[model samples]
Target: MTGRFGRCRRIAAALLTAVACQSAPPARAATPPDTTARASGVVTWAASADRMGEGTAGQGYRLVVHTSTGGSDLRVRFTNAFGDRPLTLDGVHAGLRARGAALRPGSNRPLTFGGARTVTVPAGAVAWSDPLPGRVPAGIDLVISLHTPDAAGPATGHWMAMQTSYTAQGEHTAEESDANWTRTTGSWWYVDSVTVRPARPASGAVVALGDSLTDGWQSTTDLNRRWPDYLARRLTASGGAVRGVANAGVSGNRILADGAGQAALRRLDRDVLSQPGVRTVFLFEGVNDLKAHSGVTAADLVTGYREIARRAHAAGKCVVAATVGPFKGWPEWDPAGEAVRQEVNRFLRGSPDFDAVTDFDHVLRSPYDPERLLPFFDGGDHIHPNDKGMQAMADAVGLDSLDCAR
Candidate 1:
């Protein structure tokens, strides 16, 4: 049921063996013209910019998502979309919530840089760790925690893949919050994406994109209860088409210009368009632009919607657009935001350019109001859907829309 790696050998031995193999293997000559950069080395996932623990709050913090079992040969990704000077890190460790919701060394490591713990990940770059004895599994969730004891501030927050992250007293709270992270330390700027060479290709991946509702903010951590995670399980069990899905939804992503990190339009070239063998794009995103930017007109949003449709069609990729769900009673939400959402939904329901479509609005709407999120499925944040609501959204997508299924 599990795979294991041979025990760890010091770096010197590894270098000595490589030096000897240089003769036996006959060095793979550099600059070979026939070389191809395959997808194998490229690990793809999504991230968002959120409010990390910052301010006079003394407890400034940020928790990026990472795989629980990707082995010690792995690298950690800390992010900072906006920060001054080269960000720094004190220490880094791989841990898990060992019951009581406490952090434990699920895989305690000698996390180092150039063979040391302290390193500065220059602004806008990702760092990788030297190979160690750690090998990871697919379903495992890891707590890639970053801690800082210095009063120096590099405050930039983002949406973490896990549901929630707890903090202790000082920088050590995150480290000591868990019975195991007693001596924890690490910090940096942008931990955007982590990469690990998977032993084999993933069964399959579905890229789910949308607003906060699709991101699953209030749900429990590492549970993968987001409908996309649930759908991954359902697909594997059915042994059917579209083997698994990767949630590409960012908390406040928009369809047009950059509202949070990159607008859906700019991100599409990366998120939907460039995804590897992405079977289908469960397209949904647009509410934040209408809600957050009061100046954006309904007509402008529709124009952006049509542009998405046109580009996806050109990619020869299958498309499934979900009607924007409800957000009426949100604390700062305005009535104008509601009307813009309706106009965009009307365009999506038309299903003109998309290869397939689903009515996410219809799936979560209360027949009584039709425009508001159904009471039972609302996670109280009129903007995002509850866990159950996420399930409903996934179910409405239906297996029939996927080409691999047919």
Candidate 2:
């Protein structure tokens, strides 16, 4: 009787132990999951292309571009958008400019397309290089080298680069010294966009989409004196989230017609919408369209402005319109064009369609003429602004207006 009683007690204890084991919670993971990954990219530099020029069969181009924001995973885009045939690049490289055509030792790194050494871009297409590992800083010249073994037809490139770049014969893309890169050119070829992954995830960029004035036509070359450049400096110094500035201006580019390049309306997707992390579109065009005397009316220009605003807003971006600056002294200026300009400026100033407006007309117009550029700011053509005018235009921008989400 004593043994049986002991067995029963053991069984009851075993049942309770099993119940406790089954009800216990599972152990938590030792490592916590990453919750702070950011996907936004900032465009450190850019130039807009209008047409394709002559293409050299066995040549290399050493392009120099200044960056506006610092970040890691540098990337570059080469475009053949205006070409009529396939353009093949055998090799491409990127590096920090130690000086004029010379690169910082150990900084010249080869860039690949999908891990391949060569890439051929089809007509009307663009290619992006795989992200390069390392950090690229702000306000420094970044040099890119490209070797085109076979290129022809319409060569897409940006005319009036302002900054000087190097060129040479054969495959000299691997060279760091300026030895083989003797020839110089003021135009940027194939390459159009440079982007970087910002340190902060939510950081964004602003694109200045306009014409010659925005293109820094007469501003001191290689000094980065464009209004957008000034704006970039301000954003960086202020430690704001919107630090990237892309200059998407073509000299003589218009808003309604496809003259200098494609019109602002036609190239909107490629130039503005497709850019990575663009938060605002600063529309400062129309002077060219109005002054061209192309039979464009004030109503037509206004309609174009509204279309731009609508497209940008649809893409979840802010649209900031700028009133057309005075151009009374320009050779193309006439009473009809001036009237149209005044009407367009008035609409921009009061339009609710735009998220915000900057009165460029007020800032650039002379107090005396009211329809002519300020003498102190004019670049002598009486149309485009000089360095001082560019600075003033940039200063007129309210930084707060640029830091907005849709």
Candidate 3:
């Protein structure tokens, strides 16, 4: 079933005009607000956005993302950063995913934009929905359905979700049953960040900025087994100050180059810095830069890391740097790449530029062969970690390191 679904695709339109019209201001008037100027609250769940592909008309998307810290006054944000034309959402609904396309009975609810049921997001912009007065619990599946009557051009979204989402034709936003949703997709479309007013002002969020590993590749599909997912669970269990976790990882992404998605530095402001209640920028990247053999030297990678820390600090956020892990058995592994990894790891461990450091290299590398991942921890590919290793990496992190006052 998974394999067949993987081959399937859903051509969908961007969010546009629909029922209960809530007309937005002219495209020029609508823009992504400065979240920093507003009151702070944790972003309970978020996925970075990218240009996925083209959109289809009359297409509906039901994206499911897992939440970490839960609170009331839940809100969602829709993005059109990669769209060439204004994208409009006609129907938008939120609910708990009971299973497949089904929502928990009575859990489904309609969401409006600025007191209206419709919103038109300008090209390369985003809009946040007005808060819904409901209690959204933690560690539950939040399903968001979107209907786009006139979506076209470049469709902006996260491509490697790792979790399965449902799709259908027309407006299935208000439905609680799975009957209308017939197609399945692994990408999260349009919607990016989901925030909630925290129970306490001290509770903030940590956004993990990395590549496929942080994006949960090799982890079980539909299961929250990403290292960030593990970290989120740990933070919640500890009842710490940084309880919210948002993953800003993109598969095949690099720290300095653009290919699979925008480079980490390029998308930093949109994916991490602008997020509400973000207190820490968890920096765990560079593996791709080294492996790609793109003339990126250890010095070059170090410069990238420093720039990330500098920008994050300017945003009043703490930076936690993670040592690059070993990937000896992977095809990209070579003496030059290994040396580069070592140098970068050394800088991460000793850099005062970072607020804190987590030696993920020491956590995931094999003691006997420091150049390779521990056999049990290797997710068969030698580059990505297994579920157990993900847990170990999370366990190795110092919860206190993330609770920085910024």
Best candidate, TM-score-wise? 3
Worst 10 residues of 2 by lDDT: 28-37
lDDT of 1 by residue, 238-307 (tens): 6544553556677677777676657887767644554444567777877778785467777887788778
Which has the better lDDT: candidate 2, or candidate 3?
3
Higher-lDDT candidate of 1 and 3 = 3
Deviation in angstroms for 172 in model 3?
1.3
Candidate 1, overall lDDT? 0.55
For all candidates in order, the CA lDDT equals 0.55, 0.84, 0.85
Q: After superposition, how far is residue 154 of candidate 2 from its true place, in Å?
A: 1.0
Ordered by TM-score, highest first, the candidates read: 3, 2, 1
Clash-forming residue pairs, model 2 = 52-155
What's model 1's TM-score?
0.67
Candidate 2 C-alpha lDDT tens digits along 1-406: 9995564445334433433443322222211122112223788888886676778899899999999888888888888889889778766888877678987655666776665667777788788876776677777789999998878788988988889999999989878899999999999999888999999888888999999999999899988899999989888898888889999998889999998989999988888877888989999999888875679999999999999999999999999999999988788999989999998988898999988899999999999999999999999988889999999999999988997756
